[model samples]
Target: MTSTEQAVETFDSLDPTTDEVVGTYPVHGPDAVAAAVGRARGAAEWWASLGFAGRAERLRRWKGVIVRRMAELCDVVSAETGKPKGDAQLEVVLAVEHIEWAARNARKVLGPKRRPSGLLLANQAATVEYQPLGVVGVIGPWNYPVFTPLGSVAYALAAGNAVVFKPSEYTPGVGAWLVRAFEEVVPERPVLQLVTGFGATGAALVRSDVDKIAFTGSAATGKKIMAAAAERLTPVVIEAGGKDPLLVDADADLDAAVDAAVWGAFSNAGQTCVGVERVYVHTAVYDEFVAKLTERARQVRPGEHYGPMTMRSQLDVVRRHIADALARGGRALVGGADAVGERYVRPTVLVDVPEDSAAVREETFGPTITVTRVSDMDEAVEKANDSTYGLGSTVFSRRRGMELARRLRTGMTAINAPLSFAGVAALPFGGVGESGFGRIHGPEGLREFARPKAITRQRYRMPLVMTTFARTPKTDELVRRLVTVLHGRR
Candidate 1:
């Protein structure tokens, strides 16, 4: 084999449940990442030249391929990540919807539009268009591997930039499969390429020549990725860890709130960045709500409703949080420390956990939730806002759903529902504070992978010219008057 081929090492992608190797991928190092990005830089031009209509057609065809093979992809995801088949399919379904939405809406979102010039510059016509930012580097998370990464990948591709994806070390197989599917649609160029390995490989991609990086992972990793990208002054969109909370008002529908809380807290083994980690219920309905929630949570069993924790290392984190909560005088209404098994974490529900307890304050990316009783909606909102992460949140109230949702400090909020914001491709998705910045879905997402280009042309010249050397004191005085007339009283 050539040295070029020998230089790249191989790593095994194991089934988290069985610890059996499901697939093996090359451990692409810094040199390999650089080569992939170099190729993407060239491919980006061809992709951009295709224009919106051409790219849309290609994306539509690719979407068809994904839809047709949805089951196959779901199986691969389940095997690699240890999620249930239905949950895997649900993620793929959402991913396909986003791909379709990005394809159909990119033109409207990123296309050029006329801008009104100020009265002083009325003689000029201004237009601003979003242009492709060449290559995009996407570092994806393992949880919801297909859906989360595609939020960046599909949008970036739709916006006319080529993507070089570095999936999590745990889900390289899924990433490779996605790239291969894209290759079938756009076989002409390296429009989408895959680089799989550990954190070093992701760091390499961050430091490469890609125009921007869209990273979805832990906040600590996001910081490291940001620092690496800073060396090249590259832009980044971070969808980091979130300790999301759910609020239930006194007038909320008890049944609906219970179902939403259980699903949001336990889905994907609670590995979701936006999954509900804390619940604050109005004291009037606190007893009833906790009773209903615990009953529903009891019905959920690991390896059936959900699966094992995908990352073995996370088991310890979950155990620590649960143990800490108990140690701090928190009571377990449903599951306690014993819920965290060797491979799986049973649905754990803790009550009266101290606000400072790790279970309430930290991002316990496991099947765990903490419930607290609040005096009213105000207290609930205040407690919900008391986190460094402001990612996704849920509000359940018949009368004050929207009101409470707006009060909570989060990027996206679901009123009387759970995680519905992610389904609507028109709404931007991301967070504030430690949850990271920039958006990954909707119009904002399309623009995230693009750069704005502003253009102006002199339609006609004014007699009182302010920008030319030919201007006199009279022109300057006239310009001052015009400015005063337009804004002096404002």
Candidate 2:
């Protein structure tokens, strides 16, 4: 059979709200993934040769294209992901900002700079710079597809790496739209490409010869991707799932805290990786907070502040969690077992939930939150910290916001707001433990897709050299004396 005939398999992208066929894309298999990576390898050389300035110009042009056609992109995002157009617009705007920031600041962040040679190597000149990692394979998530993937894509391109993106099956059209816009700005080379399909296709990308992989998805899928990449010893940045928590302090503004909790738990149907899945309130404010939270949560029906669960299978998970919560003596203060619909999940709030319940321990990627009361701030912090996933958290306290935020074991924290850390282009985003590792966004993100290269130049030949065998005895004695003088005292 001809290669074209063999590669004719395709999949339809559907709208979660109506189950309508939004678009279709090829089910690119291993052979296609490999070919894409090979093309990216050659493209990486040409892209890198463009240097920081050339890439930045192209990226800036790409940003202009995105801004000029923002409405069209938001439409695609909204249609494919079932998110509100406003929410989609907000994500795209953040993505444009990230692209601009990466292009504007790549040189300052990754360019070569002189470094002190230290006391031992006073006669040597030293420098360090970050070089591109050739080709990067980005496996994006359906939730916040544009904003989440651009967190890596823009920075990777700005740092001089070619990207082979494999967006989620649910949002391939959005990915195709982004690549189409980027190609208009950079038509010279295949700097950015797309391969669309399901988990097998993503597995193919992970096992391919890409220099690095940036993945954003569930922790189970993240582990599988990491293991697949390990076969080639390829580096990976895994942005996995999170059962994030929010702490309500005794001094927090009750109205503000209630608003944050409602928005944080119900936005995007609570499918956010950094979404508030659990809440720990000080006993002093537990009753008041729960009452207000329940009222606000009831106002948050599906199709208003949030949309349907993009992945249909997620509906079952949501049902299971709520059922488990109710069966285990948990009281549903808002929408409960009946809240989960065929596509949309009504906002549900559970209180007095056991800490070990699936609703609390696992990521309930739905419009639901578990609120547990604690005796004091210490107990609140302890309960919030007792989780395997440490992705993002929130603390609502006028005075102790930062203090409580610091105490939570999370990558990013929003003090008085809901998921505000993601909008800031300068703060790093990632998680620890089960939430995964490697940062995206800010300076750390720009460096994530690049490898540091260090250079040392000897200004002049020195008689007291320790790296060569020309004169070892005197050099060894001098090195020992210097080490003792410098570090021994400390």
Candidate 3:
């Protein structure tokens, strides 16, 4: 059967709040995915052939199209993710800004650069440049559909690679619309394509003959994707989940810290990978801080401030964590077990939770946060750095904010601000340890999708060459003397 006919299976993307069908898409299998990659190979070469200036022009135009139809795209994002219109617009705006930044900075970041030849190799000239790795397979997450995936897609394209994206099954319509937007700007080739389905489809794309793979999801799924890509030894970038923390020192601005924590923990219903899941407050102001936080959280509603949990499976996890914490003697200062409703989860804040409890140790991915009391900023840093996840962190301190932020063992940190690193296009986004390796933003992101090429040219022959078989004993003696003169001083 032809590739088109082989995709007989189909699925519907549903609204999380009402279970309404938003859009239906074909469940593309191995054959369909491979066909898309094969087509992308040629497109990648054609795209690369368009030098830096040419590609940047087209990318800016794509950004224009997205900007012009921002409302329509935001509607699609809101429908699929069940997020508020404002939240959807925020993510889309960030995505477009990244696209524009990547397009404009590619030449300066990836272009050829001169490398100095040492005194010993003065006869040689060296230069370095980054080249694209052709086709890339991007397996995106559903939480921040447009923004997360585009973190890789935009950089990969800027580095001159064609992309074949497999968006999460829950948000296929959003993926389809992104592909459509790209096609409208550059109608000549299939430079960017979409494949939608379940886990099997994602696996098929990973197994396909793609140059590289970029994924954003849980650590378990990232491991599976890594193992599959290992069969081909293909390069991969995995952006796994994070159980990030927010630290509040005794000298912190109590009001500002409370506000940042409320927004960081409850925004997006606490589905963000880098969202503040844990807050370590100094004992001096712990009670007062908790009171302020509780008051702020109570004012935030599910459907009004945020939206329902996009993934239904996360509801049970949130409920279990709350029950476990409560059973373990931790108290709920704001919402409790009943906060987890059928579709929406009210902002839940727990206090006096032990570090060993599941609610504090695991990723709840819901509208719940744990507040722990620390003796000092030192203890706060110690407890915050104890997580296997080192993705992002927030520090709220008037005097020691910058110092504490630098001490946190995370990829990025924000001081006196919430989720500030994520909004900055210049910062590198990724984590060490279990949070996953490889970066996906800033100049590091562009280099992640491309390979560095080092070139060397011989300027002229040396008067006293040591590499030739015809070298005399005098030449060796002179070289030894020069080495002694250059290194003996050290």
Candidate 3: residue pairs that collide: none
lDDT of 3 at 122: 90
Give per-residue CA lDDT, model 3, range 88-154, as digits (tens): 9999999998998899999999999999988888999999999999999999999999999999999
Each candidate: RMSD to true structure? 1.2, 1.7, 1.5
Model 1, runs deviating above 4 Å: 1-7
lDDT of candidates 1 onward, in order: 0.93, 0.93, 0.93
Candidates in order, TM-scores: namely: 0.98, 0.97, 0.98
Alpha-carbon deviation at 66 in model 1, angstroms:
0.5
- Cα deviation at 438, candidate 2, in Å, is 0.4
Residues 103-151 of candidate 1: C-alpha lDDT, one tens digit per residue: 9999999999999998888899999999999999999999989999999
How far residue 247's Cα lies from its native spot in candidate 3, in Å, is 0.5
State in Å the error of residue 341, model 2: 1.3
